[model samples]
Target: MAYENVEVIKRLFQRLFRDEFPNLAPAERQAFEAQLEGRIEGLLRGAAGDGKPTDFAGIIGLGPEGVQPFEDINYPRIKPDFDDSVIPTQLHAVAELYYIWQHEQMKIFQVIDVLRRLFQLGQLRIQRGPGARGLYILEKWKPLRYSRRDRMIAYRRAFNYGTTPAPAGAVVNNNFHFQLVAFMSAFAQYFRDLMISEVIKGGVALSERPFGSAATIQRLGLDLRYALDRASYGNILALTTETGQYLREILELLDTPDIKRSFDANTKWDVVEQVSQRHLGGQAELSQRAKMAESGRRALEYIAANDFSTTLDISVFHAEGKALAQHAEAWIAAYRMTAEGRRFPGVERQLRWALGVGERTARQRLTA
Candidate 1:
């Protein structure tokens, strides 16, 4: 089923860019279309190893095709703000397709590492910022938005709130490049949105005061921050399955300066590795003095139970570690501000955009 979506996705791309370059001469247009088709083919091939893009796409929507993949299921009771569009439409579909496909087929760490490989293969550039974020540049796409200040060149809206044009030197000549940029831009937006929405769903309101009305703000704030401590620990444990190398590279590339500073390299790796070894099959009975000894016992038991070549089924554990890391970062930040009685910088508008939800209304539900 996943493989079938590959062709469907390819056809979608073909239609999107077909003959969109009307200004080109006849021969030039034909050549451009040929090259465009090849590039689209390559992109699909690169992503083909995992299952269909449509499989993951189901989590977000019915897709461009109106098919519901899963059966009747009940999701947790969440606030009205949570929805499929927590991510941008184009980007959300692509990310879910890519991440879910890879996650279903590979080890958690391998899935995480693929992001760097994709960036290299697709000719994308990542520029780290001073915060827990970074900029993804499709360097061959289009000129960046610019401005003049004191007769000096300046980049206007450089970040563009997660969408920006290419730098000073870029090739905006071909229609194919433009479409590639569009796809990559959407991918970046999806990545940021996932991190944010995950944090929010874990219950830390991004905005100091959620929009709609004052009466609901305090209640929402209390409910939103309700799970901060749990979320922090949960994301950390989930991130533990990721290899030390994978974690380091991703943190640096994604410009998570805050997280980078939180722990030294050795400590970071040790924590994740220890967690992986300790919680392979299930949690050890917690004891005050035997924590390390208990972990060793678990590791030995795991080795004894499995053949040397067989990979242990550690997906659930790995997922928890990754989730722990992501939620902790956002949760910690939100927690500190709340602790100090500081509001979350009045980001109601941005929060609305991120959640894909409108003004507060009735509660809604979704299936995992």
Candidate 2:
């Protein structure tokens, strides 16, 4: 078996060896061997003490749990990379455990599903360099080998063969791109550390200009021309989220320019009202346009059906237009109930309360 014996593992790998390196170039093999050994040692430590791991035998173990809370399966396949060939154990016993054990498949690659939400995460890293491609890399959990630089390099690499590789440039393409991914990951880690400090220090200003590897190095190069200008950076931060954020952006925008100063309640409300009006029309539809439109229709129907007294009841208790939409529904409901006569009891009470034109009825109120 490919697993179960170090000799078996070696032989299997030897088959893929296009060329053998029996004479490993000095520490080349040593570094690889040490990292592999360390990975195996990590796996062993995970297995020795545990109640029982479902995939105990098949996996080399991830971390100390002997398994990671990788997948949310009810009973099994909870950990992934659990039984992967890259388990790193060259020992015979561990190999045997892996080769002999049987388990359900785990969906580890599905983790990439979160990439869609990557935009909402912390700021993206924009790598700019000569001959670099613009990339918008979504920040993700660490220990992953991706970086901002890698994404940017990917764009540059894209030109080597474009979408499909060209026959003539195959060799050059392979060398340039195949080796650039690690730098991207390293840059990401460094950027993440920097962003956190900016957020705490610059607040909303930290997100001035948003870019990812999808951006061009030329664009960044031009931008960097004035990157040293703190005033420019502050103004840009106020308009769009960007790095090299200036704390003064918040102060200037608030007209407080003084961090040591504080705004009173009334002054703060003025700021809120001003900003609110500025952003009033910017609220995009939360879901599909159809869904939001339908919700709006239902909201108006509920308001027109009921008057203010009853509208309050529906908005709080029923889902429809906001506090303002309440009375319209109650007004509508009351109009319909008037024609119904006694069919709609307590309808008038709601109508009166909603309209604010009259007192609440003695017998029943909609809220009660």
N/CA/C clash count, model 1: 15
1-368 per-residue lDDT for model 1 (tens digits): 24455556777876767547666765465467667767765666555433333444555665565555433211212224322212122222222222222222222233223333444564323334432232233223212221112001101111111123434553221121122222222222333454576587784333232222322222222222222111222112222222223334543543344323432324333322333343344222222112222222232222122222111122222343343334323332432243221432223222332223332421231111
Task: Supply the TM-score for candidate 1.
Answer: 0.16
Q: Looking at model 2, which ten-residue stretch has the lowest summed lDDT?
A: 99-108
Report the poorest 10 consecutive residues by lDDT, candidate 1: 150-159
* lDDT winner: 1
Query: Candidate 2, after superposition: displacement of residue 213 in Å?
Result: 29
